[model samples]
Target: MTSRQPNHKIPETNIKKRIAVITLKSPAHLYHCVPIACELAKNQKFKVDIYTDTEQTAALIKALTEDYNVSCRIQILHPALGNRLLNTLTRHPARAKHIISHNQDKFRHYDCIISPDFYTAPLITTSEKNRPVHVFTFHGAGDRAYGFKQQLCLYDLILVSGPMIKQRLGEEGILDCTHSVETGYPKFDLLHHTAPKKLFSNHRKTVIYAPHFQRKETSWYDWGLEVLEYFYSSRKFNLIFAPHVLLMTKWRRRKSIPKRYYTSPHLHLDFGSSNSIDMTYTQQADIYLGDVSSQVYEFLYHPRPCIFLNTKKVNWRHNPDFTHWQ
Candidate 1:
């Protein structure tokens, strides 16, 4: 017993799991993934990183990190091409390729890649070794065919809001029941718990007009101005003219708003305010008005009157594409 001696070395406990949360398009998309990112960042076992394209998105991510007291890195992905002509020729496929090439090494370093987009699916699948798990959280609740596309199968895990998404995936024969989870929309966690702010001080009933950005599907191209003018003139209801965030951002479609609309006290026009993403309008409004925006579902949480604008006047009752209308 006196001659016995033991040597022991402590095991390492400093290794942290790596996760990247990517928001490729807009601030709205970033909002959808913020809860997941924040949760992961809060855990000391994980190292969280966020990749965004725009300054607005970067700023928003920074705010979220500070607010949650979480340490995370935010990287901005700038446009690859400077030439307008070259960019115009290649479109999104070229951009996707550039993003993949730029982040290939970064993707290999992560344990998981979570994105609120479809394009990132291809990027994550490109990794051959130390391949990170790909997770997709769809950004909207709208009945769009693309939402249930076959490309989604590329993801290792799919987080959805409800049975509607699972059913849609099953119908498409792409449902991985083992990997799919109905998390009841992470965005709702913020929307439901946040106190409603008075967007308009007046007591008039408020309506939120949130039209989609698609040219073919949205009422904006056909009757957007008309709807705005109608509400502007109406003294019956206070209108929150908040279009889809992307609608006003497109260079080709950006139109000058009438000065009268801005001066009107009854109207609160927000092109892409932070309030729009936080569901302030949805929470405060008495009525929901929209063309194809999934925000209507958020407003429906309280089950109020909803008026859908069908500028195309398609037989929505019969068309599967217009299922949200039904």
Candidate 2:
């Protein structure tokens, strides 16, 4: 009898599936997808990469990783056009084109791509070779018609918060039952576990006046100053005026707060803060006041008293644009 040596080869243990989380537009959008990214990064079988367009988003990603004790690759997508003058002339659509053109090649190498917004649908769907499975997680629960556009059907998988979203998407004939998954809003997962810090020292009820940025749809262009004056003049409640993040991004013409309004101790005006995306205002506020912003849904998580401002006062009862108001 002779002992025979078995032939064996060591298998590679370093292989990990790669995924990409792309965030554009605002920090809120980035925050909406952080929970998913962090969860993916924590898994040993996968490697996660986050691509953001702003410094604030990069900082937020770093903080999230430190807080969660997970590691992932972070990339900031800066405008490829070197000159600011040329960028200003080209405008937003051109900038978006440039970003997609610069990153489309790298994105194709990933096994999967997750996006919180619909803007990236074209990039993922148009790729003819090595197209990764595209997943879309809506950043909000708003009933805007744009949310139900034909582009939504391009995604391989759509993660929705509740049956309401599924129903809406189905009605539009844009979603396939086979591809949709009912996953509760990931952003709220963080909001529910995290403790909200007290923004004001006083015990008085706090009202968060968060208006949208669009001149046509926003309350800011209509009764923004009037609303502020009402809150400033009244001493019954403390006010936190936090408008949409894009309100001051490019549009310089905005309602200037009167000096008298600032004198009031009950009023706290925040144009845009780092904590704006953290739901600090929504959690601390006793009442929710807003135009068409989806932050209203966050406030409604607690089921508090809400006041929707219809600046246009266009019969929203029949308007599909104001379906959220119903």
Candidate 3:
């Protein structure tokens, strides 16, 4: 009998899916999504690419990829040279918008794009018919209105930490249950791995005053220095005045810290550092103080005392904008 010739077509399951994990926001947002890329890269059936806007972030990604023992190409997000100077001048959210505008064609080629931000899905030419699926891993489990912002409706999948965030997003009419997944804050794993930091040598209780950056909503503009002075003079407690890492990034004006604050052994002033965003201050502080910063929730991992500052005198009672207190 004549031998039947077998078809030479390769199996579809053998094809590796291309996934892009991107973070255009500040370093703080990187913790939310980089580990996810590392985990995804472990699967040989998929190819993962990590994209960032700054060398600072590229270095961070390399360190993390090595720490996690994962393999992935790190791509820097940049506009063309023609607009690179203009792009460098603008700040984030705007800079993020510019990158998306320039990279639409490049992004559309991926099978899946994973980010810890809302910038991607809204700007890219993504439609129901689009090839690449957009997944938004939340940068924070923050309590502020930004957490439940209207822009989140653009993504195909949204990851939430727990029931509180899920319910709040759902009630806002932005989150569809089908698109939302309760991922329970993966950065907690990062925090778990990080050793506790010691800010003061004495046994005095430590207070971390971490305020939000958005000047319109931040208490930093009106009362930040005053709050620092109070802690500086009182020496009763060691103070870590590390505002949200983005605070200085957004504030174009450089407010000089008094020489006294620098000399005070009780005062630990950190404008921006890896310790600021990695829950080092949150984990170590005895008390948490902030206006709208989300590190308060991280501090509550131990259920310590918290004091919220309402410098604007706005009624936050029963207000959805200040829903974390609820």
Candidate 4:
């Protein structure tokens, strides 16, 4: 179902437009959204509110807003206990359903909903009158085919990071009738000054082996263990075995991470921690080794050596999914 395309005429008076910025699924979505909410909060014509579920998310919102020095109403939501309990068993595909089921009336009153994801709003909810205009700020700016292959046309407005994303979405015809604007990466605007932890004792060069969570395309399902063993046994470089946040987010419940990976001083294995989402691994690693994780781009901020492992013997060259490889 499609949202109401933002056809509302610009207000000539001082009436404040109410907007809701939601940060759900906790894998770098908040970083992309805080700046947008902060910017809107600066204007008198807009009344921005931040809605989230977890204490971790609320705390993050507080910290980020403090950094920006922008104050707005932050609504911390506690979804039904059953939904929270169920979310622990499966992936986050059920999150949107809970958000919609729990906050239907509250969301309908907003003039707009600015989310870090597209489908998190209209992708799940049915089209109905009084629904807020969903403005999705595309967060996963990676080259994975999943990024471009989605039904992005559902949102009322799409905010992209750069021209590359705009061009890619336009080429895919996702922008045919959608209202989108390139606002640049809002996360980057808040340059986090927090330094990474001192993991290894030695002064050896650090290497981060960050793999994506996708079962079909990620190197973790096939080559993850081998990579971990290689770094653990070799001990030549300090290895940061930090996979995508979603990997542990989903699988950490069903299976337990082998304790041996954490035995070595050279091996620093993190599964879904605040540091994992923050730029701790990205800033500390001297080299990047991974599959299809978008965090590689963040690691490239300092210009380091990167090695992308192709677990599946697919022809990635000239493929739109592997555009970042080019």
Per-prediction TM-score to the true structure, in the order listed: 0.86, 0.88, 0.89, 0.87
Positional deviation of 79 in candidate 2, in angstroms?
3.1
How many residue pairs clash per model? 0, 0, 0, 0
lDDT of 2 by residue, 133-176 (tens): 67889888877776777677767778998988898888887664
lDDT of 4 by residue, 148-228 (tens): 644666677888878888888878877776778988777666555344577778988999988887788888878788887
Candidate 2 residue spans exceeding 4 A from truth: 1-14, 82-85, 88-94, 124-129, 318-320
Most accurate candidate by lDDT: 3
lDDT of 4: 0.76
Q: Rank the candidates by TM-score, best first.
A: 3, 2, 4, 1
lDDT of each: 0.77, 0.77, 0.79, 0.76
User: What's the distance in Å from true for residue 2, model 3?
Assistant: 59
Regarding lDDT, does 3 or 4 come out ahead? Answer: 3
The TM-score obtained by model 4 is 0.87
**Top candidate (TM-score):** 3
lDDT of 1 by residue, 1-326 (tens): 01101122223478887888988766888767877898888788888999887678799788867766777899977545553347677553225456655666667778778988887866555434456777889888777786877777777788989988788787776664326788888787675345668867788998888998889888988888888899899988999988888888754554556778887988988878788787888888999889878898888888999999888886788555566678
